[model samples]
Target chain A: MSTASTGKSLAFTAGDGYHDDPPLVAGNLSFHEVTDLVALHTEKKTPMAWYGAFSIANIGLMILLLSVAYLFWNGVGVWGLNNPVGWGYAIVNFVFWVGIGHAGTLISAILYLFRQKWRTAINRSAEAMTIFAVICALLFPTIHVGRVWAIYWSLPIPNQMEMWPQFKSPLLWDVFAVSVYFTVSLVFWYVGLVPDLATLRDRTPLTKKLRQKVLGFFALGWNGANRHWRNYEKAYLLLAALATPLVLSVHSVVSFDFAVSIIPGWHTTIFPPYFVAGAIFSGFGMVMTLMVIARKVYHMENIITINHLEKMNIIILLTGTMVGFAYITEFFIAWYSGSPYEQYAFINRATGPYAWAYWTMMSCNLLFPQFFWFKKLRRNVAFMFVVSIFVNIGMWFERFVIVVTSLHRDYLPSAWDYYTPTAIDVLTLIGSFGLFFTLFLIFLRFLPMVALAEVKMVMPQSDPHFYEGHGDGHGAAHDLSAGKPESDRGKS
Target chain B: MLKELTRETKATMGIYEPRRDKVYGLLAEFSDPGALLHAAEGVREAGYKHFDTHSPFPVHGMDRAMGLGNSKVGYITLVGGITGLAVATWLQWWTGGVDYPLDISGKPFFAWEPSIPIMFELTILFAALAAVAGMFALNGLPRPYNPLFYSENFSRVTDDAFFLHVAASDGRFDMEKTEQLLRDLGALYVEVIEDLGTEQGPAGDVRGEAVEKAQA
Candidate 1:
């Protein structure tokens, strides 16, 4: 279960003269051990560090509440909104939060369908992150509408005069896409939690009758009947299948909000895929940022091992490269098209007033993740942590570059102006992080952060042939890929 | 003859019911999924119909071992998806094209190209909804009580233990013989599950009666 590879060569498996494949659950713990370890976080006395982190998060939440209240009182004019640069920090933050939400669905839905057993350990908390990020994302559009009271007019419902929202607008499409994504992701997350909740219910002491009853009610009297699992597993597969496309479509629709417009920077066919790639890049960054701390604070190193972090770093490398490719491709197309405005937009992004923001994005997103190509650097906890922070910042700048740089320079030179975020804009952005972490900390304290039931199923003991002494001759010390259930094996 | 007829009528009407002390089934515990799966296959091969295996997580190939066909939840999901597609199409067409048409920038009203995102979202939304709902419905979840809960050892089924329950309702059920059969199939421990003092009726009716008793 050691995460360190001893082989001199970079090989994937032990059989081919390379170091052994690192384990998913590093300690070779039993099912009971896993259950106890995860449940302890929720059942035990609150940790001192948890109190420290929670207070910090609460301060952020307070700031968010105050800033939002101020905005509502004074109106959108209080923030920095000029004539040419209409879309500002509000749109940038909205996109940033939504991008952060994608990692959860990717880990939960896409990875499950691909039979990646390593996903079991982190999927639960990652999905929780997705839900919280979406909540923060939804806040922007609602408050940015200025007339929050009349936001219902955006729905399909007819107003007093029978006029409906413009169906052709990408803005309305975004509403439907994001709402459905949230709803489906919630159901998927809850369905996965049922069995784990049952474990908590069963383990509750006699004195905590209230806690037991609450968990039991939510557990829905689950008895782990194979008849139920037969349907439960099928439902899970179906949801995963549905969510895979749903995740892809959600961000593509968001991109359409920009692509459908006639702006030189926004009106490009590659925007959909480009945006989707950028989203996944940023989402994984956020996941790493939280997970690095969560595992250490909760003493979950065995469950979420260095091997898991290494695998995630590889993904970051791949997606970061894709985003970088899109950045270059945009410049190429601008030059190839011979359109003066498109050329100017791309040139201006690199050499104009916002050149500092553009280069910061390049180095943080493109240059920093390149370190992950070296196995040692990616596996080093401190190095990945710093890169993840850079990823978060760079992605925000990516959105900023897309929204402000293009809008600041319109067709007329007289309309050109540099847009800077006011104190409110900066406070609101910081406050959104406050909202995300507040909900996340509460989840960590209350619910099982790791998916206990799913993790157990990935252990060697869950294999039917394991007890017969013929479990691939690996004994109990097998890696996660080796411990995959029989039903998953034959398919591939 | 008249007395016999009255007794039959009362039994049918649920007025005459068996005592709660009756054995519900034989509950068998296994050390791991392998043994439990082998026992499931043994039970199925023995032609025992009302038997089920329990564990913390779903065991692979369990359906085949227990002689279960593919789950019917997919059919429900398919129907839900189709309904969503239809509804989304109708809503967009009626609101934009037929009801109150708009001529903004000379774009057509209710085109399928622009409507694809909404349609796709709704399709996934409804399918996911039906999949979860149908799975719960098929599994008969949220039942306030089950006779299996009467066995103290069965509590571990949600954690480290594996279990098999053969219902007394099975046509082939014989209390002593089934217990022996489970032991032969290598159950680590076995116990007789009994229906304790609870309402002896449909799950819904039992829930209603229990709630009333609690309120009183």
Candidate 2:
């Protein structure tokens, strides 16, 4: 895993090449002080800015609830969905939220496997975002099925439900895929939170009994016993291992919902990998948007260092380009397939009715992220935030272009009709953001925003010191435990 | 009167009970991970079986230093995964081929190609659930109270200090000798925890059950 490039260079890492900056965390922080620093946020009253953001998020939540109720009350017709354009804003928003959810798992699970120490500062918040985004994503498909009450029938539950869910259908597969993803992510997030919660509990000696009970309850009696830590670390690694594959499959199955179908733009073989990449792309964008604001508001300049932002931007740049590549590949396939409908479906996307959305997606997802190629811009917080916002908007449009554009003009020209989202559709989409933020805000308010213990682990002071020619001169010469676990042994 | 009644009810419900007994075990605190790790090695080498170390996080070599074996959570996940695959495949075959067969597309009633996504999802579902369930079952969690919580000095285990607790139940545990040993090993603070033998209280026997299960 050492960065050594032979021959022609195709390098991904920015840190591998450039940027000599301060340490990841700012200020001379001792290991003992991490608990106190993070606990300060929870112990103190909510900031005025927090209240402002909270109220805004509350309004959005209200909108989301009303929209869901209205959709159920009146039916799917409340939105602008119809025969030709059946998969409109609901599917679009679902995919968008799901894509946004990807960065959390990528940061927490994938980066943990890769031993990316920089991720420690932002991983907790991103993981929370992932959970919240998934929650929003789950809402779409459930309510999209007009008879929301009959949604249970879609699941592969047993004898009670008259109809068994069709195994072959990608839609039914989504039921299993999404639910499993949610459960696993929730468990992973909670388990990671346990040690931090215990720290909060221990530090809050001056807090009221209610606070004590709450923190203690969630801390799960974790005493940081080495035996417990051993098991906990193993469990964490196992969850991370499981989650990496699970997150990939969850999105791949989502892609299958379209890819398995006979629709022209939807039926491409590249959808699985393409969707996963784009999900990571969009996920990073959302993470960037949050981290930029959070690091500032929480005074985490040192912890979420500029280098961390630069590294993330590099990922955003990479994945955004890959998505651009997928777009080109799709066009090549459409032309190569020699089918008129397939050709027409893609060509229409570029020059057809929804051409504005298509171009917007191209500009936002592809062009905007390419700015990160310059180190100056990537490190520039304001510019990165703007680009991240653009990425979010672009990714949403990417899904919209895929779902609505492909479906609107199908095999029969007679059935072709323009699909426009009703007010409820617009409001609902906005409302999902509300739900995401509300949960995220609550998380930020109560929990340690950064993984304090994990962040501490990456600190230089945590490592064992070797005082040469001193007392116990070489602490265990030929230290067997020092190396990575060889076949899971402590020593010979 | 109302407030007093509420307080009385809360106290009786054990909500107001102390989080831990002050007398848990002998606590030895270390300033750094190295010191703590060295102390763990010393404790392990001295043939103390019932002792444990508490720290802010999992130190890299603590497991090996403590002579602990690798975790068995993987075995549970593997078994659960295989079960998921078998059950999902069988259920799919029964539903699509045998019980309620439908051939709308003229493909086989039971197609493995189409079943892959759902099957993969189920396998992961089972594996993930097992991993979490195994973790909880292994870690002995949801125990909100521990005797360590009672010690003022021990609370810093999640903060700055490194700690090793030698249980009185350990056959080799002699109070003065243990304290002297911990001090020699560079423990900044050493507190011999007295076992009052009170009711297990809110911490429950979850850890004990998990440890037993793991051993068995």
Candidate 3:
């Protein structure tokens, strides 16, 4: 323990030491680098595969819009909404979109708080996914009211009509919850974009003055100062902390829309946490589906990285397991609680007229993510893509099971009636995919897919050690006589 | 004019000759941050201002040794949170209270329990917005240029380098004395830095230069 004249130990301590090696420069794509990206998007024209996908999406969107128009022009009676089964595909899609929106907030907020560096690569895209998914979700609830123009009547304000929204209604809670969720998520997404927008502002050679002005305004004149970096980091951390709870609460409130009801399967204590887990599971699945396509099309494999995809797969697996657990626990509780109605509801879900949907939900949400337990399977992009599709399918069925199954069979046996989707319902459902993809495609074309500044922060070469060895015997003294040369330290 | 006037005044006042302080020691490099932090603490204890430590990354305790205080971001977040809560309550009250009231469900109007979700969301919304906005405000962002970029050696910040700069701005900062102090504090190299007086250029050009330097 010989202390140097500097009054610090000169001996090397292996575990307690801090290695300040330079950040590794994997590679960076600057603004100029995006020319290749633009070329791929535009000059490549529409590939035969993309053409098919786009056409399918467009057709779906058209059908959906047409159905919506029909609903608005005609009424809710256009679809199969009779006595017992009031809610239909519209509500199902709303829940599904809300669930899909979960992955974005989870990726941006939860993972960010944990200081998961891999999040930098995928957060931007996921945030966009959340926003778009929410938009898609809002459509269903708005149209589901039948009288779309009278949607404002649901608000709590004292009006000339002398009416006020019911304080106890779960639907009203949804109104506030979803709106607030959307607003906060939007702000979070925009704030995150500020630094990146500045990067883009500097990078894009927009000859048009309006483009420059608009970009400049959005960028908020970010200069990336040290003080700015410090504040930005703090703000980002705080936001992440705020958002973490919001993510859990929003979906739980959505679950309350069903759980608060006395309608057998809908009224369960486990719905909140279970819904949140299922939301995350399905959301991650959507992320996987989108990421695979985006990475391949944009040729951004280096930035997106295998590590990111692997981490996402892990999340999918964990959440999928949680969903499976919830499913089991719901059944077990129903049987153990000795509630005949609960038992009947669970049984009806499995062996009823909509048993196909129930099984689909079970296999897709539970069985697909299990493949990720194997490293080889998790690494297989195509396999993961398939699993992701299955997860989506399962999540859709989960909503279907919650809605259609519960309503199809009530306590009053005389009121029980088989419900089936009209062709318009199916077409409208297909059109939602079109709406989602169209928005996504537009986003991909314009926005920076990757958060460049955040990624730069994580690169190895950004470490301070590269400048440590300059000057005197001080370098030798600091090396702790571990016998490793300065050159060797630099190499490592 | 200011420099000449200062020199003349110093000569007239007969206080021109500054006291010479000599420091002597062997300087070393710190590739490991723990060593750098230890050295920083040692220097701080020794009452040295002309010495600094460099590392490839920011060590957890390094700021304390460097005499930095806790970041003020929490204050911003707190204010943001309050604002969010207020706004959320107000929005719900206004919308559900005054904007439009309908009896869709057979429940009382202006429900507070359901409003909790919106309240929670707004709080987070404001808090997050404030955090980001506060960060930009505090950090003085959108500054496209910095004086540090003039030094080619500063590029190592993005790579592997932890540097403690003992600028002339410090009270103990003298050419020889600072160099000797750095030597005593285990600095591997102590170099005198000159402030490049190119402040009169157009802001855009300066920004371009900074960008070019960063890219380089």
How do the residues A338-441 of candidate 1 rate in per-residue lDDT, one tens digit apiece?
A: 99999999999999999999999999999999999998898899999999999999999999999999999999999899999999999999999999999999
- Model 3 per-residue lDDT tens digits across residues A299-399: 77756756578789999999999999999998999999899999999988888888898889999999888989998888788999999999999999999
> For each candidate, C-alpha RMSD in Å?
7.6, 10.2, 9.9
lDDT against the true structure, each candidate: 0.84, 0.80, 0.68
Ranking by TM-score: 1, 2, 3
> Residues A57-167, candidate 2, lDDT per residue (tens digit)?
999999999999988999998999889898989999999999899999999999999988899999999999999999999999999999999888886677664557778
TM-score of each: 0.90, 0.88, 0.73
**Top DockQ prediction, candidate number:** 1
Best candidate, lDDT: 1
Q: Roughly what TM-score does model 1 have, to 2 decimal places?
A: 0.90
Distance from true location, Cα of A453 in model 2, Å? 1.2
Candidate 1 scores a C-alpha RMSD against the true structure in Å of 7.6
Clashing pairs in 2: A25-A302, A26-A302, B23-B194, B25-B193
Interface RMSD of 1: 8.0
